[model samples]
Target: MTLSAPPVPDNDLMRYLRERGSTRNFKTDPIPDAWLEALLAAGQRAPTSSNMQVYSIVVVKDAQTKQKLAEFAGNQKHIIDSPVFLALCADLNGPALACEMHGTSFHGQTFEKGLVAAIDASLVGMTISLAAGTMGLSTVMIGAMRNKPLEVAELLGLPPRVFVVFGLCVGWPKTSPIPKPRLPMPAVVHQERYDASRLPELVEQYNRELAQYYRDQNRETPDDAWTQVISDKYSKPARQHLRQHLNTLGFGLE
Candidate 1:
């Protein structure tokens, strides 16, 4: 049997996605409460594993709290600048409560359970980003929320089995930046199998493209920009205590 492809027309959503860039600088104007609610509602519609919905979003608007969170996130000004900072968290607490209601114990200490929660959180976060884009709002995801996981959790008053996977800053853009170039399709897409033969070649090609992109933006970067940045970042152990911290936060990650 043969399958036919649906004829899809070009639309604003596709254009917005292709051209969207991480927004670091944001206007101080607050997002309307109605808009925020709509965005969160859209995010909840994201597909979840087994309808578990094992994720939660903590919305932070207090200046002092944002200030503390900014410090915890390596002094990211965007976290403090954006009118709203969203802590997208992977939560096992709700599932545990559900099990209790049923008079059964929830064994969510396994790595698979931890992974599923993270995936669920990530899906919702991406959906929120897309929804925000549609509303002419911009955003940046802060993975630095994990830089000091324990401190972050403490600041947010997270309970056991609930930890922030990342953060999202949402607001109007203060300055519009062009989207960074991504790896070519040949580098990322494989034809029904894993491919590594062209990795080196692809890396070399992407380095040139990325370096030129930086140059055009008047940013100084090495010729081997991508390779050097990644190597320097990974040369030493990164977040060496992350596993212990996660365990302390009650994510078994076994």
Candidate 2:
């Protein structure tokens, strides 16, 4: 089957997005306060769940703290090398306090609300990364912070009802990796209803594309395809104990 021509980006913002890719190698150059503030402002403008804004960012600039976080995050050297490390958290403490002042009950203790906070934090994190990219900065989100959630919370001095969803390493890029290919448009985007009739074929094509990407980067190719990567990461439990940890942290999973 012939694929249609890819649409050209209509503007600089769209073009930037198309060119966006994660950068692991970072320069030690410090991002200016003004640029940081602007990037944050851009994140603040991101949509949230009913404007509840159930997220917070803890900026870690202390060398010792980054070192500790590097250890916590599976010894990813980039965590320590980046100029700024941000612990993006799902925060309900502020809303709970607000409810207290109003003599009202805060209703975000349920498991669904926990999910909401996670979603909110993730949305803001993406927004911040995009804003950073717009300013020629690079970012890599660290998912390994969940490896030791209780310790990370203790290290960051988070209050009850707040948990780090992930950490983000942001700085000037030493180099940019090629943008990874995604599943074909049809494989992901369905028109009016759900459809997967062509999924297998589309995914097979994607596997070839990704294999080529790996070969170009001189990286070891995983067997099978993206499905194998997904299965390998998720076959067993990646972080099976997080539910209990979240409960201990006051999320309660009610």
For each candidate, give its TM-score against the true structure. 0.96, 0.93
1-254: candidate 2 lDDT, tens digit per residue? 99999987587578677888888899989989988888888888889998889999999988899999999889999998999998999999878989999999988779889999999999999999988987789999999999989999999999999999999999999987579999999999999999999999999899888988888888888645688887788878678889899998889675
Model 2 segments more than 4 A misplaced? 1-9
lDDT values of the candidates?
A: 0.93, 0.90
Estimate the Cα RMSD of every predicted model relative to the unseen true structure.
Answer: 2.1, 3.5
lDDT of 1 by residue, 1-254 (tens): 88888877768789888889999999999999999999999999999999999999999999999999999888999999999999999999889999999999889988999999999999999999999998899999999999999999988899999989999999999887599999878898999998989999999999999999999999999999899999999898988888899999999986
lDDT measured at residue 108 in model 2 versus the true structure, 0 to 100: 74
Model 1, residue pairs in steric clash: none
Native-structure RMSD, model 1: 2.1
After superposing all C-alphas onto the true structure, candidate 2 shows an RMSD in angstroms of 3.5
* Top candidate, metric lDDT: 1
Candidate 1 structure lDDT: 0.93
